[model samples]
Target: MSSDADRDGDARPGPGRAQRDHWERTYGAHPGMYGDEPSAPAVRAAEVFLALGARNVLELGAGHGRDALFFARSGLTVTAADFSPAGLDQLGARATADGLSDRVTTAVVDVRDPLPFADASVDAVFAHMLLCMALSTEEIHSLVAEVRRVLRPGGTFVYTVRHTGDAHYGAGTGHGDDIWEHGGFAVHFFSRALVDALVEGWTLDEVIAFEEGDLPRRLWRVTQTRR
Candidate 1:
């Protein structure tokens, strides 16, 4: 007998692709889920970019445009990208409402694929809690390479990731490669070594320890510059 799994074939997407559906539903269920305020990291990143005279930025995993809109308001041209179209729609609507449509643009991007921008194109990049998504180590490395490819020389890249010290690090269902799923959300907790490894060939600026949310998720905000 051909079971349901057999009939469906082996076309199932990996956890990373499945996350797109989860995020779509999440955004649909709760628009502006992360609130309208810019996160602490975004505010700090803006300071860094402005100090460096950065005029444009590419933001990955930009959900609902809270930080992207903030960057636009800070007088930087912004490109916001995420895998979920629903999230981008909300971001677009909010940008229009805030009269930031001209300053901000939205693109649906899966970081696993090559980035859409040209080489040495952007002045800065910011990703908050993005690298910690259900991506594997190899995918993370590839995405970082793409980030470097798109950023101009001396461009700044600021990103945050939930680290191994987080309360939920070993909790929930383990999906291998340090990925854990809880309440429909999957995360790849980062080790210190992994963080150091990602900075290869770049000038490592600083790694700050921080906490966020009710769970007080432990995270490291990493800043680096292209040599």
Candidate 2:
């Protein structure tokens, strides 16, 4: 939770211990996992920013920099941070291959702690498919607080998370969730009321809950501005 820990160049154990370990093992076992595309929610949220002429975006939990690459290519200064070193490595490689090495900067840091950037240094913070899987409500609040701390007044926080109404909430998808085991961790499902309370100080600009494809998925798309 310390600022030094967040900006630390060295890796250290943090609050997201189980979540980090789960992703490390998951991505390690299947290096090519998740392919090389940004999540649909990420793409949609980025488009909203583009239309609004927002730049200097930061992506928390940027798994493999898929969305980071897209933002960079769209002419936004992007800083993508992830807790997993392996994920950042893949992101760097992908950026290099896509000729986006100059546009994107990859950082291996935990967002549950203080972020590396200076206060109010970014125009927007994007967290796609992040923040919902924390084992505790405190962790989720901490993550949201960090986002608010780094954003300037009126700055936007755009993110998506698995909806509580989804059928996969209690079911194990072979990728954690279900029961909280050693390798497996807790996944918190959020409802609209929960999200509203989480962003109390912020002005809610938009909220969308929709199902994607054939998977009984529920995605909460929230766009909020700092108060």
Candidate 3:
């Protein structure tokens, strides 16, 4: 098997075609790798979304449509987008199975480029474990800007990323706050200060840092209004 670092090194953009092809192959090989359920952080983020009374919700990298399904089940209009057609296929199947075909819409989108939505079209945007996949800080910032651009005035942007202070910073071992690059793919770490700087226009609502077992994690829940 190829190491994570090897995979990170091979993961790069190529006129959209290559990127889409790569993820398609990956998801095709492992149809439901991310499973049919949302992660713990996503569940936690949903609580905040519920409290905010958000109606039109966008999941930037909706891998398996897990969180998207959660929002749809709550009666929110959801647009679940991913870069991989294979992933979207699985998500669509899951949505149909959950009887959310009407409430959930699936799209193939790559966040590294301009988002496929009109400005201020979405009420809230949620991305779980999406930022770290970016190859560089510039890409990360661009993704954030895209999220900001699509969000309505006073919309909320909630996401969770690996904590920077973790012990295994960058080995693709899910440790520490280091940038792990392997097999054309990478995971970037972020500190609270870095996130604040990246999210320049957004208000810093809350930065929660905690350890899950041996790993340290950070949850950033920010609510920003359009300026």
Candidate 4:
């Protein structure tokens, strides 16, 4: 679920601006950069949701709605949320083309801002590789709390993050924390300790290691259920 990054020869800290702008420009510049197919982690998540009888899914950072459409087609109503307006538009276009507009909803939501979903409204929350994006440990924990708040009791929060075991983990510009920036993108690598700390108030179901892409982007697929 992790996105590609340049780790070989990246420079010092990128200048500060809205992270949303970076993502918007990234999507706008390269259409279908991540492609239309649902990621492997997403496919596994859909299976877990169906097993849990989750009828509605809230997907954070649902770029291009790939995973959202997969969930919707699997009979779960999906709300595909992302900060990039253009990304949402692409997702809407695809949903329309696939005649899934009825089952899928799109929203422009910045995860750094408060989530717009009502409390205890969704049966499941899924965010693939979104938790690793340029967020501090505090911010990541806060976001998880919000995810928990928006889930019904026993609803699952499924997410993935770049693992500290990744080959790219220590190669980029170091933040002296778990985070590192390369090619203007920041990724907060997750350790078992950090994940253990973040899963407070939820039951940790799994933390499986996996890889994606030719860079062999190593990741941890962590799952938690609201208590």
Clash count list over all predictions: 0, 0, 25, 0
Rank list by lDDT: 1, 4, 2, 3
Question: Candidate 2's residue-wise lDDT over 156-226, tens digit each?
Answer: 89988777687766665333332222226545677666788888789899888867657766788888998
| Location of the lowest summed lDDT over 10 successive residues in candidate 2 | 174-183
lDDT of 3 by residue, 20-100 (tens): 456678889988886666676667767777787788889877877778888888778899988776788888998888788
Query: For model 2, what is the error of residue 41's alpha carbon versus the real structure, in angstroms, after optimal superposition?
Result: 1.4
TM-score of 3: 0.80
| lDDT tens digits by residue: candidate 1, 89-108 | 99999999999999998988
Which pairs of residues clash in candidate 2, taking residues 3 or more apart in a chain or in different chains?
Answer: none
Q: List clashing residue pairs in candidate 1.
A: none
Q: Please estimate how well model 4 matches the true structure, expressed as its whole-model Cα lDDT.
A: 0.84
User: Better model by lDDT, 1 or 2?
Assistant: 1
Better of 3 and 4 by lDDT: 4
Off by over 4 Å in 1: 1-13
Q: Which stretches of candidate 2 lie over 4 Å from their true place?
A: 1-15, 172-185
The CA lDDT at 15 in model 3 is: 23
- Tell me the tens digit of each residue's lDDT in model 4 across 112-191: 55687789999999999899987777778889999999999999989999988988788878775677877767788899
Error of 2 at 47 (Å): 1.6
